[model samples]
Target: MHIEIFITTNYYIGCFFIYFFMLYYCYYFYNMNRKSKRILVYGIVLLCVFGMVVVYKKNSTLPLVILNAVRFYFAGNPTEDVGYAPVSSKDFTVSVLASGLTAPTRIALTPDGEYMIVTQLTGEVFVFSRKNGVWNNKSRLAGKIDTSVLGFPPEELGLVGAVFSSDYADTGNIFFLYTYKNSEGEIENRVSVVSLKERFGTLVFSADPEVIFTANVPGNFSHQITDGIGVSIEGKSHLLFLIGEGFDAKRAQDLTLEGGKVMVIQADGSNPLGVRPYPSFPKLQAVGIRNAYTLAQNQYDARKRVLIGDTGPDIHDRIIYAPFF
Candidate 1:
């Protein structure tokens, strides 16, 4: 089944009201009594009038959300006695399952390998689980956690990383890494941990996220930016992440600003928590890389070697075997 996304002008109209509500609420609270109340009401009315103007203008211009659908086809022989493995076979029934997901860019399985956490770039975390051999719909992980509050640009920010504790079977701690844009037009890399519960065979995750750590990084192109994050092997509240150099690769040389660098920290502590400098690590672990978008521990390695896929300039792609020194 093919899914489609359609744009609407009311989206901006709704956004105006939301922005005005926040602004007016503060105005109403700062100065009490009839005067403030009147001001707040008048401001809200003006915002409503402006919202209609924006809605009408937007509706007159564009009405369809840009969308793209990718289809994958297996290309090999299907016969058992024949050549290469094929995507279609009698024993291997194939079907395309669709989830009502809006640009789900990242997916990770729980440490128990029982639950799948899918993150939408549009500020939504959808959790899927298998029960009796059936995949269920979304179990919202970070429901309505406004990405705008993090100061991350909507086009550039996303729930980028999710992982379970190495001891998740024993401890229910789950970790997350996402982008937030502040009012200063700076992007922040945020991390947190939460627990999952099986309520009467229904897997439910926590709503109130416990912050683990946060690092501010600069933003590049809305689409070309690169970032990476993952939990350490030992799971002693440690995390590893990569910040990109973006358009200016030289900015990574500045340590005071976490640009084009890998950062390590303990999640169970305060800001700047037990941070280890990325430059101090082994040079061979990472070399000639501009931006890294994905990070993971190689399960094949006995020591669980850290692997990074750094998206290089032009069309270059570098996969580095990064081991913690």
Candidate 2:
């Protein structure tokens, strides 16, 4: 059933109401004096109602593009015929480094580059070492650490990433990011620090994990928190990572919130010392990101550039690199 109401500049407004205001809006547009006004009303009403409906329904999804009024004036995302740049096989060769692992989500190499720590989506952590041009199993660093596997949309949750401290050989500190169900049964992401020790040629955890950072978002995962790494910006070691908007795209612009932002913190999760932080936010390096997937950093003497993989508001998944300093 539908109810319709008609109104104009001088016409009497109807008192009719419905579960959605679209019913009256459509009716009002039909009685518009100009075709241009009717078209404008129709376009806006349809876009908003359709988008909201998609978000509320289970299994329903929005358009691939992020809906943003600001991006409309800018050039569209760059695309190519084959989707990615092609490299010559003579210059580079791809090979499997390791196998027999289940869903390895994040990996970190020690500062000495002797051992690599790998974390799986199933919450298992393993280590591997290279010998004679071949990768060999080192040991299982951890297993069944417990992760929230509810992040199906884009699968951006779980044991997402890990980073080794600059002095990993001496400090043995490894930072891991993973998702878990909080006491309220809501999925939350946390960064935990663990010390790894080698005893009798086997790697093992040295102590109880120390929780460093915790982020709370909606249970449904679209853009959860992502990877972090240790970087020296101007010779100061700091922890840098990225986060997604987690369905609240507007919050990406909010510096007070961690969503859709780049955060720079200490290895122990304190506000980074020595270097000046990003603008007013002590922990936040940058904001206004969509789905922060992966972060890669390159440094030369103190100049550091961070490459960020972000899935967009629309179909434009992008890899953007910039220096926060």
Candidate 3:
């Protein structure tokens, strides 16, 4: 709860527009006309009396920091300006708990929230079960190490990233950041941690997998390691990942090279909580990044912030706000 971390990059990402600038000013007063709907109904009656004085001052982190800024919105900017509003809020409701399931990507929950640890791009790892609230039973974490995404650039690389192990529901263990081949075979990039269970109902991997770090790059297949998201702060669990400069991108502005940045460690399997200076990354927290494809953490704020959606090389896609001290 003593989270303070800071570092910025706001070409108008001005710290994530202070949480969607009031939902893009309520999406410009929902296409105003009737005197801007009475000034958007007096700004929703002064935001329902300023959210009942911020929920009677309990301020549960300002409504989970606007629901983690609408679950860290991911679409829109198909060249903004044609009524740029990518946040709709009917008090939120977006469904589809399960589907054809393949090439999934990322989603981890279990910090005792029942379960929901999906990840795929041809490396698989599913596990639903939200008790009765919809998420269903879709198990699937079968074993196999030395696994590589193998999905090849079809929408970009495989096994992008995965996390879980801040006591993964009593230590089912998890963590991986694809693309292997080490021991001098070249194809670098790995981040193990394995160990899982639940046999009969499906969910294997109770052995090999503890290589927690690696990097050699030149694998050149797309920014490779994209997420790890597991932060603890006071309890000390840390694992915030991202590394995709494999295509060289000027060696991610060279900080003794580890490509891109945001790579921390010690996610409950201790070691290396050191060195970080230059463009930093010997456990660095932030640095000239790109391809920040996925990372959105708020942890009920106290500024535990970790939102980094930075992707640029054309059309500046900023939103880098790492916080933790």
Candidate 4:
């Protein structure tokens, strides 16, 4: 549907440009002097020659040549295409680990590296493992979360992120972030934890999930439910979360709200870490963020520096870094 709309719109735009230019040429041809007319005739002849070359060869060189000529006229230099060099066959190889997935968003592996958990954007989780020297897909629904109830498109409101616990091998705990519609018919984002277990020789999750956090957001704003989730690495007791501003930039600076901030809390959702000079919201790590699309903790840095990719408002994108104490 989107592709059809795009092609139709561009087709109309191309028609408009062609007709408008034709009318302009007809009007100017009668009013221009002899020298101007000669120049216009030469330009039209050159364009016809270029079009014939493009139509006959069906190659990209004509467009590139035209673009290079324009660059030379404006910047006094034309771009050169350096040919590719030959390389040995052993330089690269490809392997397929898994297949037949529906819009897979995130993949989390068990601490022991024996099992892999894959999450789908359509609200499903699959577990993959190796058996008898071959990887097998043994996926099952993790819970009974109804994605249809979200009352919005899957791109806007659906399962967005997932992560495994650091002690997943022993505890079998997993976390997820998704969007849902509340009782008031308002869209909301939620983060929850659930335990995975083997029942009747098949891996499955508990029927219920322990809800950790949720935020009410406007239903029409799709960017409200951005990707960010808590991850435990190297037996770290603290879990890190990056929340977006929900299209409300002012809420980012407000300490009362969780939007547009880095939050750190214990694994059990207790004992929120306090930011210096602001102990009121212990979970608040940093604020004044517009839209943190990506978050990472530096493994090599001794200070446990947290890096954030913030989507700015009409100006520029920014990468922010701060200590994750």
Best by lDDT: 2
CA lDDT of every candidate: 0.56, 0.66, 0.63, 0.63
Maximum-TM-score candidate: 2
Candidate 2 structure quality by residue, lDDT tens digits, 1-325? 1111221211122112222456656667666679767676676666565545444342232333233323543645323342433397777766556667666777777676666778887677787766565567445555445675633233545778788766676677777777776676566767788888876544667877777887644423457777887765455556778777877887788777778888777877877765565556788888878887798777662556778888877988888878776
**Ten contiguous residues with the weakest lDDT in model 3:** 2-11
In terms of lDDT, the poorest run of 10 residues in model 1 is: 63-72
Cα lDDT of candidate 4 equals 0.63
TM-score of candidate 1 against the unseen true structure? 0.61
TM-scores across all candidates?
0.61, 0.66, 0.30, 0.62
lDDT of 4 by residue, 21-97 (tens): 56768998989999988887776666555454433354223344455446656764222563444465488544466
State the lDDT of candidate 1 residue by residue for 1-325, as single tens digits: 1111222445565666768687768765666788877777787777766655555454331121111111112333323475445476866754434545666667777765667777776556666777776766646454433456322222456566666665566656666666666687565656666766665544456456676655445554332223434454343545566666655666566555555666665556332333343445421123344677777777788777778787766777788886653
User: Runs in model 4 with CA error above 4 Å?
Assistant: 1-92, 131-134, 137-140, 147-154, 198-203, 216-220, 225-236, 271-277
Alpha-carbon runs more than 4 Å astray in model 2: 1-98, 137-144, 148-156, 216-219, 233-237, 275-280
Error of 4 at 231 (Å): 6.3
lDDT of 3 by residue, 178-254 (tens): 76644654556677887677666446678877776776454444565778676655565667788877656776777
Q: Point out the higher-scoring one by TM-score: 3 or 4.
A: 4
**Superposed model 3: Cα runs more than 4 Å off:** 1-44, 47-49, 52-173, 176-194, 197-202, 205-240, 243-261, 264-268, 272-282, 285-291, 294-315, 318-325
Error of 4 at 34 (Å): 37
Q: List the residue pairs that clash in candidate 1.
A: 7-65, 150-180, 150-181, 151-180, 151-181, 151-182, 152-180, 152-181
